[model samples]
Target: MATTTHSAARSGGVRLHVQRFGTFLSNMVLPNIGAFIAWGLITALFIETGWITTIGKALGYTGGYGFVEDLGAWGSGSEGTGIVGPMITYLLPLLIGYTGGRMMYNDNLRGGVVGAIATMGAIAGASVPMFLGAMIMGPLGGWSMKKLDALWSHKIRPGFEMLVNNFSAGIWGGFLAVIGFVLAGPLVEAFSTLASKVVNTLVDNGLLPLTSIFIEPAKILFLNNAINQGILTPLGTTEAAQAGQSILFLLEANPGPGLGLLLAFALFGRGAAKASAPGAILIQFVGGIHEIYFPYVLAKPKLIAAVILGGMAGVATNVVFGSGLRSPASPGSIIAVWAASPPGALVGVTASVLVAAGVTFLVAAFLLKLDKSNDDGDLTAATAAMEANKGKKSSVAGTLVGSGAARGNGPIHSIVFACDAGMGSSAMGASVLRKKVHGAGFTDVTVVNKAISSLTDTYDLVVTHEDLTQRAEQRTGSARHVSVNNFMDSPRYDEIVELLQQTNGAAGANGAAAVDGAAVGIPGGRSSGGGDLLSRDSIVLDGRASGRDAAITEAGELLVAAGAVDGSYVPAMHERETSVSTYMGNLLAIPHGTNEAKPAIRRSAISFVRYPQGIDWNGKEVKFVIGVAGAGDDHLKLLGKIAEVFTDSAQVARLEAARTPADVQAVLGAMQPA
Candidate 1:
């Protein structure tokens, strides 16, 4: 279940770690796929050995004007003149470098300019187009600028900040450009040369079909863009320039396997998967959105074998017929694949796709028929798992009815404002939201700002700039993450405020009359029991722990002895910890049950335990452990007091010095009656 959500626990698996790295590499190029398509179109129709050049000569269109020959960049009249060579050589690599830089800097445009400037050196130094160099320099330039800025971020005077920033970026870019020219260009060029040699070796030895064993599984894991743009596109573009077409483009972009799998599900699958397969087929095959079928394969895990075999057959057929495409076929649509096929290779390309589709359909149909159990794979759970891999919800996943797509498990009472640096934009956003929240008479809701790296699972809602939203979600898996472009004003803020108002209104309507919260065990909401939140007996002065798990268990025991929660809720506390770290900075750690464990609460209570040895908690030191159990909203007040005390380092220091349970209670300013 920990793997089902984005968290530190999820990163424990080696496959998911590789998947995330691949996804990052692909994200830099996926945004600029349109430029690649445009370049492909021009190269296919107008190159010297392309479709137009072959036809124009027979039709006698190549006249004294030299239009056909010029367009094709041949006949010694035009050598480096056509849009094909320059676009592939210059435009594509620059775009990739710029996008990579922006990503590393958290969407700051200054980072992009610096990165592009640095990438120019690598491009000039390399003999080829420098696509690989661009990938290296772009992110490097952006990250360098970020670290440089952090050194003196707030040190500049108010009016001179912009001037310093602009000059600093220019100077830093010039320095990196020199470095990239001297180092990165040759290293990346040599690597790209090696890659080309490897691909040629595989093709010559008839071992190219074996690539499907890795490619098919990677595509299912949503690493298709990484394998295509980050690797195959650059290599294929170079091959196409020398030869008329390259078979590398057809490896991952072959849509036949996905089409066949969906067709099989449409025929033999049960329930929503069967009904959705027909609609998904149109989206996956014609629309060129291969991801539309990933849920189907993931749901039935056995279907992977079918796609792998089908992909192998397609590659083998293409290799045998000497078939290849002029450029990458993105989205892996049947139409794009056909359109990108070389004029002379149409028949062979057609045969390859048909054969792959036929093999996959037969294999998938057999697997579905063999399943005799009433139970089948659940599409909803699979889609959720897919989104977990994606790090965010997919718009395509919504077309399926049973996906259960929702953010955050409980009410949005605690909202966090995060940014690249917590001091600037996030602070402003939190201030604006706090104003709106208090203005609407919902003063109980808490809004605060923090650095992106400092985010914790204690927050129910987290707001960050659009570029930083993915980072925020990676840190706090269960939090409902919201991305807003502007800190001063955003429409999303209004939507959030409205949602809270409507939710509160619904709650008010549901229980118009007075009710007893203590008797019924009010779950995950505020109840009206205002008793003493802490007592002397609830404080433990001599408890010690060796690790995070042991410390959390001890905290849960204190709550259970205080008669705040049931014994079953102890495991729930561990669940919450695994989802995200509960270590609140300032030598403090809060251990509490998950939102689902709210029913186990008998009443609202708070407990404190002091660790003399200071436990090691996920690389952080913790000397104080606070246990929380809230019946309704009563526990929030106690939590708020602790939060306030921790903000002042002096008060925290005083609390840490206390030796007895009574002294600890006095430091907290909460001395409960006996």
Candidate 2:
């Protein structure tokens, strides 16, 4: 039945659509992350006021490290210029072109070569290295190559295909390269000049801190790469060349705001968040992986305000104290920030970071006032509800009708990991799931990562972050959708694993064998008329239990009385409850013993109990409690049946309204096996 919702899971609201566009922009820069880090390292070590220069000078006085001093001198002077200039002029363009080409068509060399050619042309025509030219020309060149290939592949003679291919590529490459040199050169220069002017104006006018209002929010939305590599780095490069340092380096590279938010969550948050926040703080602050803090803020979106305030505080502090970085910090780590801080500006940098953290901590603490006393059950329930209500999230087995088009049916052949930028978190997530899938022995299932625009109806399942759920669904026509609030810690993977197992099992059997839904009697036998596993003794018209735990115990007692399982199963069920709520949605929950308690089952049976007043199955209201006891995989059929029942809201309403044990028996009898 999947999970029933109070409202349909809809996608493609104006905000989500805007996010999709932003995500596309981010992806253009994301594939070149390794290159950015390399550039950052070079900029940090070789610039005059950079870390290497300061360290080399200090060591030279202490130990006569003349070679180190000379190296720093060369790095800070002409040698550094020789290195950084060619990097932007030649290598960066080629790398970006190749990646952009591959993004359009996987395992194709032609697109990459074409893109590089175009970028080289752009560089030749430009006065500067033309970083933005590479971005535009690379994708343009690749897409052009793909279109040309499609046009020529079918029409050309088979024997002379290679000749045609080579000639066509050469022709296109030369033309585009020349075109880029002519048109892209002037266009890139104009853009770069305008961008630099705007940034310089802001810094000159003392409005540099106000940039955080945009930077902080964009970072949370996974646009850090776009803002950093695509925009700030170019401007920073020009400024660093002139003044030996640039405040632009600190714009997206500041980790203070993220650290502050994590600290607040660590101190004042509840459940998994509180426990996870400390580790996140270490990763974000010390390790300088700012991506760690992104999910934390995403979990509670209001926390973005705190990060913005903190960023503003840090930027303002940098401005007041005249603290600037010789280069951009790669990971935005505190240590990296310190290393890049100008001479005698370490104190100012430290003060800025501290103030930012303190301000963010206070704001985040006020925003995220979590209750420490909440139990695991409540926490799980609250989290589930959040996922359920998340925009356009649905399983293939069910349709969540709302504003979006109804999704296609699926046996789930292909799984896609989608995000704002396909290369970042989505790629990592795909690898994680791919490993899990291989471990589970589903070697045939294809797992891929892609940007939202790249998604297609051919995919069976789409896993995406909560913030991008609607946009993902909007693109994933009829594909089963699942969203994770914390991409790092998605328990839903366990469910997907189970589904895969079932899928494999069905494939092996080569038959759509039926699993029982509402069994009433002993294994391989039914009661005279059909009300078998669920007898009157097992059926409770009015549950005597006041709470979810008590109701589960009541159901367990009935199961034991029916000889389906023994006394040990009760505690086993309780323990399972602690790990994950058994709530399956549609006012229904299927509570059962742990996997270790499989031996406790004497025979397969179900004890159906109605809790009219409703016991809190975590935070969800569970009216129907089906306590199941089965020896092996025998219980799956019954679970499937229950899912089917839950899918039909009318059927669930009928079952929920059933008054007597006889009426409940009738409801169970109505579920015929498939």
Candidate 3:
């Protein structure tokens, strides 16, 4: 009978694990669809509107325009366009964050607030330490909120009314969001201004040549006529023709800056420097996506100083000369700048480009040399430590026990060792059993050490010490429980080996075998069917002795001892207690594992801790404690069970007043399973 029960439990666990994997995959992929749609809509709106053309004209372009024709005006267009684009992008992140938070934390308001905070952090974090800042802050903010919620709101709160009223807890979530944006805004503006100043200072020093090369001609073609005259100058009827003529003149200017930018990249860029340089030159010289140089800037930020210095010098030289162009530079070429700007403007643009390039080159070379010299500072010890740690982490096995698998006595393919605390003896026992099993020639079998409460209806067989057998049995109804205090002292090891041999013999004879048996008893005085299992005994003590806190603590420890939870679980419980009391509508408190350490173990057990006096739980007095543990995909099912039982006002009243361990068990036994 025991063998049958164990086999059935193992099969159920395997199914549960597969279902969990499916749910996880769904969560990862489904949310992104909404974000993609939102981005697409914003992009389409930009393409449809004429805002791009108007902004380009305002920025000093003279050619006929349409939305799609002007790429530069997309990001930094008019105030209206700028506002819309960013707002659209912002909505997607906010939605994803809020939805994800609510689902994970079980508090909608807090989740939404956390999501908003994360968005704010991401925005601010993007500016300072560069893109990495955004990546770190977003995830960190989310993680912090999750821990906070788990620690406080779910563990400490007493009643349903109190837990619901504690929604105000989310208000604190906005604090980080506010701080991140405030600090990031000023820093980004400062960096932009500093970048501009660096260019000006280098030009003033005259160490770089003042000859318009790249940007000069592009500036003359685009900025001179439209921004300087068409848009900035009076636009009355009398000035219309002059505006057109000015536009034509700027268009015809020399494209010196375009050439200079190309030359700078060709000379300095590391990868495919020569090839990329000409390509960059051709693109800037004709297509005009100034952002093309951004990658180069990232590869070597110090190069920016030189680029700016060279640009300033080249612009100054072009200004001092009497070079100019008559029309806007369409293809930012030297010919275009000559055609667009008058002689003086042309020379100024040329001079600025040459100066910026030279400054950029020198700064880049110096920085590279300095970096090489400092490369050997302190990395050797760090690398060795990291490699050693990596080896350990990799050696740890993944969760190999699948759900819905039968436990058989046949050559065991897998062994799941469980105990109450998941620490101490259970772990040691598992290691010993695994070695013995290996010695029996079943080398391919996998052995896992876990807390008893975490034992699901999965695994070929579950080997546990005596203390945890009942809890394991209650949790995974069909799992075959092999109660062993010590593998070395017990005859169960030989029994297991004989069972395997018998199954193999059966297979050889009839092509079918009884692979596994139900819960097997050792040939010892102490058996799983012993009469020592605790029964109901009504005893009322000072509520303090058996209060919610005491019960939860004791139950948690028992679970840990049984290998149902980890020893570190107390901290996780405390953290949950801090957020709110987990005690819900009735006498039940659903305490879950908050950290990554015990996320896969989940079991429901009742600890009848009687208190002589009740302890203050939020505003209510509490006596009994019911400890709930569930993790991974079982979270929802566990929560559903709590919700169904506690939602009944009558059921809660009886549970709170229950007197003994058996009485506590009776209350749970009477409740309908969700």
Tens-digit lDDT string for candidate 3 (85-197): 34333554455445445445533345545655655654554432222222223334555666665454324433442444345344545665665566643554365346435
Ranking according to lDDT, highest score first: 1, 2, 3
Better of 1 and 3 by lDDT: 1
Query: lDDT (CA) for every model shown?
Result: 0.74, 0.66, 0.42
Query: Candidate 3 — worst ten consecutive residues by lDDT sum?
Result: 393-402
Q: Tell me the tens digit of each residue's lDDT in model 1 across 1-674.
A: 55566665654466667766777778887888888888777777777666776666668876542554455562233243556777777788889889988878756777788989889889878877777888899999988887786555424443454578899999999898898889998998888789889988998999999999999988877777678877888788778766768889889988889889989988988888888889988998899888888888888889899999999999999999999998788868889988888777888888889888889999999998896532235787788777766655666886664435344645667888886534334544665665556556566678877777678767878998776687887788767778886444467888888877765443333222322111122222233554456767778876655667667777777778877789877777765554445665577777777666778988877778888778787788888887777676565545544654555577677887898776766666541211
**RMSD versus native structure for model 3:** 20.2
Candidate closer to the true structure by lDDT (higher is better), 2 or 3: 2
User: Candidate 3: which stretches are off by over 4 Å?
Assistant: 1-45, 48-84, 92-112, 121-137, 150-155, 160-168, 188-412, 415-571, 574-674
Per-residue error for 187 in candidate 1, Å, reads 3.0
TM-score of 1: 0.66
List residue ranges in candidate 2 displaced over 4 A: 1-18, 47-52, 59-81, 223-226, 241-243, 287-302, 326-330, 335-348, 366-674
What does candidate 3 score on TM? Answer: 0.33
Per-residue error at 482 for model 2, in Å?
19
The digit string of per-residue lDDT tens for model 2 on 1-674 reads: 33333222233244355555555544555666566556545655654555666776777744543443343342246433335445655776678766666445332567788888888898889776566787788778878887676553433432454577788888998899999999998899888778778977887898989999999877765556667876776667556545656788888888889888888877887766677677767777888877666656656667788999999999889888877776567668998888666665777888889989989999998887753353234434433343333323323111111224333343567888885434334544565565455446565667777667577666878888665677777666467778764333357766776777765453333123422222222233353323345566787867766666667777888888887888887777664554335565567766777666767877777788887888776677778788877553334344444544555677778887887777765654566643
